[model samples]
Each structure stands twice: as C-alpha cells, then as structure tokens.
Target chain A: MSLDAPTDHTGLRVMGAEECLERLASVPVGRIAFTGNGKVAILPVHHVVKGVDVCFRTSGGSKIEAAADHASVGFEVDSYDPSTRSGWSVTVSGIATVVDDDGLVVELEASDPTPWTMGDRSREVWIRIRTDELSGRELTRT
Target chain B: MSLDAPTDHTGLRVMGAEECLERLASVPVGRIAFTGNGKVAILPVHHVVKGVDVCFRTSGGSKIEAAADHASVGFEVDSYDPSTRSGWSVTVSGIATVVDDDGLVVELEASDPTPWTMGDRSREVWIRIRTDELSGRELTRT
Candidate 1:
C-alpha cells in the first residue's frame, strides 16, 4: 500500500487472531498494561512466547502485586520504521497470573532475556497472557 | 558515566524536569496506556505538549471511552540507537481527560504535526500528568 493514498479516517482493517499472535512473537519488546491505584500503568517488558502465552520476568514489587490476581491485562508489541513512515502493532488481551511452576521458571530463566528494569532477583515474577483476544494493525507508509 | 560502569537496575540518573519536557516535546510519537474492559490496552499516539500536559488527537472511540473519568494513564517516549546500544526513555504518569477548550486546541493545531495514523480527528483528548512524577534515563554508550 502506498503511503500517499487517500486517507480513510473511518476504515480500520481488523487482523485475525492467529496472525496477530505470530507477529507479536516475532518482536522482542512490548508494553504491558494493567491497573494500579485506580489508574492505568504501562511498563515496557522483554518477552518470550511459549505455546500461546506471552511471558516475561519482573523483579517483584508493585507491578506484580497489582497484576497478580488481575482478571485481565493488555500486552502490545509494535515496530516502526520512521524512514519509511510504516509500522505494525499487535495487542493481546487476557487474564494475568504469576507463573510459579518450577519447570516453567527454569525454562524462562534459560531463555536469559534481559529485564527492562535493573533490579536484584528479589522481585522475580513472571506473567503470562492468554492469546484468545488478539488483534493487530499495519500502517502503510504514507 | 561510562557504559562499563555498573549501575543499579532501577537506578536511573535523573535529568532536570525542563530537560525531560524538552525531550518529550521533540518526539512526535508516544504510547498511551489505559484500562479497557478490565484489561490493559496501550495504543501509540501522535501527541503535542501544552506546558506539562501531553495532548493527542484520537478517533474518540476506544482510547477516549476507556480513559474517561480520571483514568490513571502513562505516556512514554523513548529513543534507542541500536548500534551503540544506547537509549533514553521518559515516562509521564497522570490522569487523562477529554479537553474542549478551543483556544488551547487551536494553539495545538497550529503546531501542524503530521499524524502517525491515517485518520481524521474524531476526538481530541488531553492527558495531564504531574511534572514532578516524570522521570527519565539515558544509557551511556560503551
């Protein structure tokens, strides 16, 4: 699609669920959204995909405390190339929970992903989001 | 500070508030976070600054509707240079509200920013965050 095409302010193409998941998995960084203190907080996280869940490590504290039992959360991954003025984004909506299974923790640690925050392991926590409600958008260069 | 120096994981050397605001003003894109249907939803917004309040034009649908009634929101802007493995990020935390003030809108529109999304202005929402709560971090190149 050409970036100079007539703009369609009312038109938004909805992407399929499966496609959104695939694209989201390809990206390494995304923002995690959750409610805290009656307001919305977004934090950047480095994530890895396992099966249909998105998982990331956090160093304890408020983020996990607020989201552990949270019924739903949002995870989004996007990439933009300013030179081309084009990018795509994928958003996944699902419940969040603390991943405590020993086996899963080992696997997650084996991945050795860099944490977004510089902290000791005192706040080690992992959150996974279900993949049922996933959607995406691709912005063409214009 | 040299990149080789060990730094606290969460220890981000603070920049002056005005410096933070100046950096934010130069950036055209940022991520807006809110609670949508009890889940976390984050969308990229093309925003402008009015003093300390961050304002952006949206479609007046999901982003606006979900953020109504003093929603706690986070607006984040960052720039990364992969070759040097260096970057800086600034986050603003505050409530989001729909603004109807014509004079402020006209001043904002006069800036003539190029919209990141292909859409007309169905809604113009302003999110105001406290300047004191704003923080930033810059990574030193090795």
Candidate 2:
C-alpha cells in the first residue's frame, strides 16, 4: 500500500436491500447503463424512485432504442467525499421499458422527473427500469 | 422544458477529443463499466489517464472477468452542479486488458492509480482500456 493511504482506518460495508432502495430514492440524478449498437453505453439522467422502479426522462436516443429492445440495464447513484474517505454507491440491475400506462404515468408525473438537455418536454419518453436486483456498498470509517 | 431547469440559459455542448482527455486527466476518480454475465455493471475507481488509456486498479472482480474475456468496457467521469444546471461528462469506450508489462508497469507506477476498496494494494490488478472511441458532452450555461 502507498504511504498516501488515509490515516484513519476504513472498511467496505455491504448495505442491506431496504437501505439500498431508500438511498436510491434519495437521489434525483443517476446514470443508466445499457447496451446499444453492440456497445455498453451510459447516460447521466434525472431520475425518480417509484415503488422499487426507477423512472427517468429521455428525448429519444440510445436509451430509448435500448428500452425498445427490452434490454437489461444498470442504474447507479453515488455520493463520495474524498476528505472523509467515505461514500456510498447503489446499483440496480433490471429490465428497461417505456412507460405507456396512463395510471402509472399519472403517478410518476407527480414526481416530475425532468429531462436534462432536451429541447422539448412534450416529446420526452418515460423509461422505467423494473428492478430485479438491488445492492449497494459503503466505504465507512472503521 | 423543465421549470426546474436552470433559470439562466443553458445548452449542451459537445467536447472535442483533446479537451476530453484533458478533463479526464484533471480528475483522479471515474467509473468503469463493462458487460458481465449479460448485465452491464459499473464500479467507481481511482484512475489515471495514460496517454489515451484509462488505467485503474482492482483486486479482481467482474472487471477482471470481463477483461479476461477481452470485453468492451465503458469508463465514465462527470461533474454536475444542480444549482448551475451545468456539468460535463466524459465517456471512453474501449477494449480492456490487464497490464503485466514490467516496463509499462514501472512507468505507470510513477502516476500511482490506487484501488479504492481493495484491502491489499500488492494484490491489486491494473486494468487498462485501450480507447477506441472517446466522446464527451458538457451541460453549459448559454
């Protein structure tokens, strides 16, 4: 180990499932990773948590293409503090699809998941990830 | 189209190749993503931009598994300020491999890319992504 290692002791801890979901709900932004055009690509997106599912807005791109394929995707949210040498990251692996159901769309509408860079909101497509696995890791002071 | 969108005018800017590498080197941390077991996974890692390759250390995990398979990997780094509605993200997609060359290791040693959560640095594996594609986007105030 390099001498530059942090002076205080730290350890990696595995977070419980419920805690992972709670943390996921705490962030409004995260990244979505999907395979499109034979490459695994990732996009940072504005997101909201809805009953164990992740909802995000996109204005039709690789993400929408992947969702059309019913692709398996990974969504991640993290907070890191280099000064304290502590942080937590949560990862959700799930199937991604477009949201077309009116009832669920109305529910999600209240959360107001926003698109980051699109010119038009009316043209946005709502993508939902039906989470199959939820896990997280935290780096904590020992 | 977001009411919450930064009230000040903002636009998405595409970054050129050289500026992307400069920004990549400016930060010591980034996330490496790869396809493993039919799912894309991501890990936050300490990285060094070597010429055009991104080198990070890990004690062997899904990243190693994918590298061993000569898998295409995605490395992403970004910074965003919700208040400014501005930030930038740089992503490198490339084929990943383990670095075992003594000469290159000694050269890479000078930069010292450390593993974040691994216990023993001595057992750390250095994975390099020989970048085939490099692109970046910045959310900028217009």
Candidate 3:
C-alpha cells in the first residue's frame, strides 16, 4: 500500500491511475485553470473529492462563471519537498459544470472544504470537474 | 518592504504589484495553464522571472508546443501553510511565444531553471510569457 518506490536513473516515475486518484482525494486544495473572457486563468481553490469528480465552491466571479460555461477545464494539485527535491503532481482535465442539486450541495458543505479565508464568500455556486483525463508524475532521489 | 501584514477582519488582502513580482521571482516552480488544441491544459513548470516576463524551457511536446502557438497563457505559483491556514497565490496572464533569439536562449539556460526530472529533456526551445496582467491575493488568520 506504500505509494513510495525506489527511484530509477531519471529519478522520475509516472504514477498509476489509482495512485493519482488517491492523491487527488487526499489533497484539500488545488489550482483550477480555465479560459475566462478569452483569457487563460488559474486560481487556487479549496476542493473536495466526491467519488471520481473534483468539486469546489465559488462566489460568483467572472472566472468561475466562465468556467461553468466553458467546455473543458484543468485542475492540478501537488506536494513537493524542497529539502529532498521529491514530490508528486496530479492533473485532471475534464468538463466543468455547476452543481445545482440542492441535496448534494448541502451534503458537500458538511465536509468543510469551504474557502479558508474569512469573508462573505458564501460560495453560492458549486462547480465540479468530471475526471475525463487524469495523469500524474512523481520524483524522488535514489 | 515586508510582504507579511497583520491579518485583517476579512483575513484577506490584495497584494501590491511590486510584492507580487518579488514573490514570483523568488519561487523556482509554478503551473502553466493554456488552451491547446481546443483542450484546457495545466502543467508544472520551472520558470524564471526575467524583468516583467516569465520564461521557461520546454522540449517539443503537444501541450507546450500548443501553448506557444496560443495567444494567451496563464502562470501561477502559491505557498500555503496547513497548520496556520495561511497562504498567498499569484497569477499572471499574458501572450506566450517561442524565443528564437539564439543569444538570449543561451543566457536563459545558464540560469538552470530547467526540468527537475532527469532525462534527455534537452529543452532546446525557450518559451517566454509576456506579463500583460498580474494579480495576487494573500490569506491569513487573525
């Protein structure tokens, strides 16, 4: 069950799909990338893994609103250790859509993945990225 | 001169342009997001802040290659502390293009911000993203 493995010559290894999904579910934060108003945009977001999908709450904004309308979006999360120069990065690309189901929204809120910053970021809208394509890479010193 | 500031009621503050630039230059790694071949893509990339522009090296690949052809791209770097629930995120959006200047390519490679994955990723092609718009936000707990 250990995700760690002996490093090879290149010190880099492609992570398996299961490991990628495990890492995605374990991380509470990631960056969501989407094209908004004809511009590429990336924003740090607090997220929760629901099954195989990634969901995050947002107060209405041009970027998140645009992502809801866009056909495709990118999500990335990583853990790196500077001292050891080791870590892994996981990226998921999929369709992003608004989660309008009332019951599900309430259920998600119970997980407490809301924005860490204290403010009126009530996050009325919830967006979920369905995992169409998932990939990851890990690096470690031998 | 201190990037650190007292946590306000909102627990959030807008960072000044100079401070944003300073943090970006100090970080050696970031995520690059772009729309390539009609798909959203985000990849971890090691970049150097050269003046107001962000530069990185890439070997010929569909994702990075497509980014070079795209008109606009997104770059982001962030640092978060889980225990303190504090962090800052900086994002830059601009046009991306291949750097064909032979002399300049040599100078950039000398900085050694290339891929950490050891391999024959010669990364002869140098890509530069012109920072047309830059923004950042910080979060802290009182």
Candidate 4:
C-alpha cells in the first residue's frame, strides 16, 4: 500500500481494488444508495463482508420496500483521517435483493456487528451486493 | 421537527420541507450518484446552495461526463454525532445538468465552499439539481 503524505490542497491517490476491499472489510459503517419515490435515498448502515459481497441488516420499511423490486443500487464505504488530512473511499454498484432464508438468518445472528446506533432488531432484513465492479480513490496529505 | 429518539435501527424521522432543505444547505460536503456504464457511480462533492437548487464544481471527467445525459441522480448530505448518538441525513433526487453560464460561475466563485477535499481548479463545471423533491430522516440514540 502506498502511504504518501498529502501536500498543499491537492494530493489524491487512486487505490487498487484489492486494497480498497481490504480497507472496507476493516470498517463496518457505510452509506447505501437506492431509489425512492423517483429519487435516491442514501442511508448509513452497519455492514459485514461475506466473501466479496457486502451484507447489512435493516428493518423492512422504506429502504426494504423501495429495494424490493431489485432496483439498481450503490453501496459506498469511506474513512477519513482529519489529523493527516488524508482518507480513502470505496463505492460498489449493483442490484440489491432481500435475503429471507432461515438458515442464513441463523448464521448472521451469530455474527456481531459493531453497532454505533441503538435500536431494536424488529425488522431483520439483509442486503448483499456483488463486489466485482468496485472502484475507489484515496487522498493523502503530502 | 420531531426530536424523539427512534427505537428502531432504521433512521426514519420525517421533517418539514424547509427544514430538510436547510440541512442540505448548511452542509458543504455530500455525495452525488449517477449512472455510468450501466452501473451507479457515487462521487463525493463540495456543494453550495443556489436558491432552491444545489450547485457544485466538477471537471470534464468521470463525474461530469457520466452525468451528461441528464440521468436520474441522487445527492445526499448528512451528519452523525457519535457522542450524542443523534444525527440527521437529507437526500435530494433529481435530474442533473451541466451549467456553463459565466454569470452563474461568477456567482458561485464569489461564494466559498467548505473545502472538505483536496483538488485544484483545473476544470470549472457546475451541476444543479432542482429541489422540488426532497426528503430527510433524523435519528436520536435511545
């Protein structure tokens, strides 16, 4: 991995696919984009890595309802270091579908997501997206 | 605006139209989503408020190029306070178009952006999205 310092106000580096995915795996927070009422809604989610696909649990409300039709969606994960004035961001674009298998739910229940928000798991819905078409950019303070 | 804490993990707090637009206006940084090569590309942008529309600068590259066809786009601005575990997010979905009017450029140049990223003014392109359709959600930690 290239760890160059950022300079001036214009030091941006492109991150390779593998490096981006690795960084994403380490972080659990990201924004998920989907269509809603002829517009787009971006929501923050706590996600996990299942192979190359990114999975996250959500309640069956607007997000699940809007994405029920398997609409095209985008998932983005990014981390910024303010002290160094550097950061990296990764975006994944794919179709989203609801996962409703009892066996899969059992497996996901065993895994713990580093939750930053407090809430009840009333609506347990899962969203998975393919990671083949992933691209990212990293900015360093040099 | 309802300030009650959300019991569910889903960050769903409805706000008035004016309040929603005000949140989007106050924030200088946001992500812009567009369709590219049959896939969605979400790019972070520094935006300024122009009347009811949101405006931002971009180069004649990936972002501007992909959004040239006036495709359906989504723009989002949000803030999360981990300390209080309270935050809100606003999303705008509309058609995007490239504006090259010098008058508008002069108007935008006079205004200052929050400068959250590092990039030079190599290219000067402006993007505007109508604010007729806007929605938002606020979440308070329980």
Tens-digit lDDT string for candidate 3 (A12-120): 6777888889999887789999987899899998888888889887766636765676469999999887666567899999999888898888888887754676655
True contacts kept of 3: 0.75
Top-scoring candidate (lDDT): 3
Could you list the iRMS of every candidate? 2.7, 3.5, 2.8, 4.0
DockQ winner, 1 or 2: 1
Q: Say which prediction, candidate 2 or candidate 3, comes out ahead on TM-score.
A: 3
lDDT of 1 by residue, B14-127 (tens): 566777798888777778877756567777766888888788777656555456556677778877654454567777888777666777667767774566666656554544
Error of 1 at B93 (Å): 1.5
lDDT of 4 by residue, B11-123 (tens): 55677778888998876677887766655667777788887788887755645545755667888887776556567778887778777688987788778633455455665
Taking the candidates in order, what DockQ does each have?
0.53, 0.40, 0.57, 0.36
As for candidate 4, its interface RMSD to one decimal place is 4.0
**Cα-based lDDT for every prediction:** 0.69, 0.75, 0.80, 0.69
Give fnat for candidates 1, 2 and onward, in order.
0.56, 0.39, 0.75, 0.39
**Rank ordering of all candidates by TM-score, starting from the highest:** 3, 2, 1, 4
Candidate 1 has a DockQ of 0.53
Per-residue lDDT of model 2, residues A1-142, tens digit only? 2334332222467777888899998876788888777887877887889889898777655445455457888889888876665688898999988888988887787767445674556666678999999988877655
Model 1 lDDT per residue over A1-117, tens place: 443433334344456666777888886677777777665667666688887788887766756545657457777887777766567778877778888788988888788545545
TM-score of chain B of each: 0.81, 0.84, 0.85, 0.82
Q: lDDT for model 2, on a 0 to 1 scale?
A: 0.75
TM-score winner, 2 or 4: 2
Top of the candidates by TM-score: 3
Model 4: per-residue Cα lDDT over A1-142, one tens digit each: 4455323224556667677689778776677877666655667776787777777777667464457457677888776654564667788877777767777766766775444444456655676765657767776555
**Alpha carbon lDDT at B131, candidate 2:** 94
